[model samples]
Target: MAANGKSRNLESFVKQQLEGAQKRFGDLEQEAGKVFRTLKARSKGQAREVEKLLGQINSDALLENPKVKEFGRKATQVSTDLRKRLDGLQTKAVEAVGVASQAQVKELNRELSRLSKKLDQLLPASVKKVTSRGSRVSAS
Candidate 1:
């Protein structure tokens, strides 16, 4: 009976632990989402700024000089390459966030499963203890 009571207590404890873990996972997921959104906005703004700079340079007197023209072309190409790299990085960041989110979820599930199994091992003895005592007590 004492063992049975112990099992119930352990079960209740495990349930609380699982709930806490789930809440933590939710908070982490929300934070990750916010970070992803911020990165996306910043990338877009940066791309726009680069485009504006390139446009201004192209319209300037430097474009009329042969030597300057070559330099300007090279600069534009570099800018384009940088923009492409940024885009690739942004895509990778998104993918990383997704993978991290999945990993977190999996971690939470594994924790819950482990706690549940531990509770299962302890519950029978707790129930037996409670029954033998012949009195009801709050699990909390």
Candidate 2:
């Protein structure tokens, strides 16, 4: 009789836990739905804005000028050539100094960050990568 009572209590406890979990999951589902709806609305608004911007862009008659286009093409080529020369100079500087340049350091840091995120996924959740710099944001 005692054993039966214990088994009955255990079964009731399990049922209660299951019900609680189901309720929590239902709440989570509702929250997720709300978030999805919010994001969907925001995305739709952005899409409309982008569409209007593109329409305005298409309506611009100045872009159709051949002379304007030729000038743009030449400007682009000059900029590209100048960029190549500058990059060559930068590389020569880095070689002469026998050290990584700021640009190189930033690129390496970015690659390290990407790899660290991937590595973190494979490792335990308790582990996190640390950053030396404080939070600093740059304008585009």
Candidate 3:
């Protein structure tokens, strides 16, 4: 009879623990759902704002405003200036590193090819035959 009472107490304890865990998980799920809905609502509102702004940008009234036109001009000028500065910095960095720029490399390749062709033309027929027999021949 004592063993039977102890068994009943253990079962009751396990059942209470399971019920507590289920309640906690349910509360967490409800909180997560509420957060997701709030974010979705805010995202929809922002999307509407973006659409309205796009419509305004395309409107003739906004485009014709002097302030807007001035802003556009300033923006273009800033972009151009930034590009020029970047190009200058890139050129300086390339020169400092002693590495050939693209243009210089291209010119060098063209010159090398021309010289190779000239050397091949100048070499005697006998030299080409010797080159094929395992000995390398190169024009100075």
Candidate 4:
């Protein structure tokens, strides 16, 4: 009875450790997803703003203010260029901070997943066939 209880306690401890590890992995995955979403949303919002402004400049009503339209166009171009440069700088900054960008993280995760699947597929064949018989084991 004592041995059985000890075994059960050990099993539960192992189970708890596994659960904790799984939870941490899930949290990291979620954080990576959030980072990707944040980067994507910022870029998309900048693009949408530029597009909306450009569209307004092209509208028929804005023709009376040609100077205003020209300035708006210039502003849009400047904004687009600035956003690109800013994004580039931001990526470099993130690299400098020793944290992989969301894109790199995602790619690494994808490659890891692919390799894991491949490993799983090959694992069975890679394993040595252990014979229960002493004679067969001794022959190896």
- State the C-alpha lDDT per candidate: 0.72, 0.69, 0.73, 0.69
Which is superior by TM-score, 1 or 3? 1
TM-score of 1: 0.38
Model 1 per-residue lDDT tens digits across residues 1-140? 46557758877976786676577657766887998899999999999998888787855675688997898789999999999997997567555434334676699679868876775676654442344566744453
Cα deviation of 138, candidate 2, in Å = 81
Candidate 2 residue runs with Cα over 4 Å from true position? 54-140
For lDDT, the strongest prediction is 3
TM-score of 2: 0.37
Which scores better on TM-score, 1 or 4? 1
lDDT of 4 by residue, 1-140 (tens): 34436547866975786576566656766877899899999999999998988787756666668897899899999999999997997667555545555797699679767865664565454242336762222222
lDDT of 2 by residue, 1-140 (tens): 34436547866975786576566656666876898899999999999998888787754575787887998899999999999997997567445544555787699679767865675566543333334674434333
In model 4, the runs with Cα more than 4 Å from the true position are: 1-63, 106-140
Q: Tell me how many residue pairs clash in candidate 4.
A: 0
RMSD of 1: 10.5
Candidate 3 per-residue C-alpha lDDT over 18-113 given as tens digits, one digit per residue, 9 for 90 to 100: 576566656655876898899999999999998988877767887899998999999999999999997997577546545566797699679767
Candidate 4: residue pairs that collide: none
Give the Cα RMSD of candidate 2: 24.1
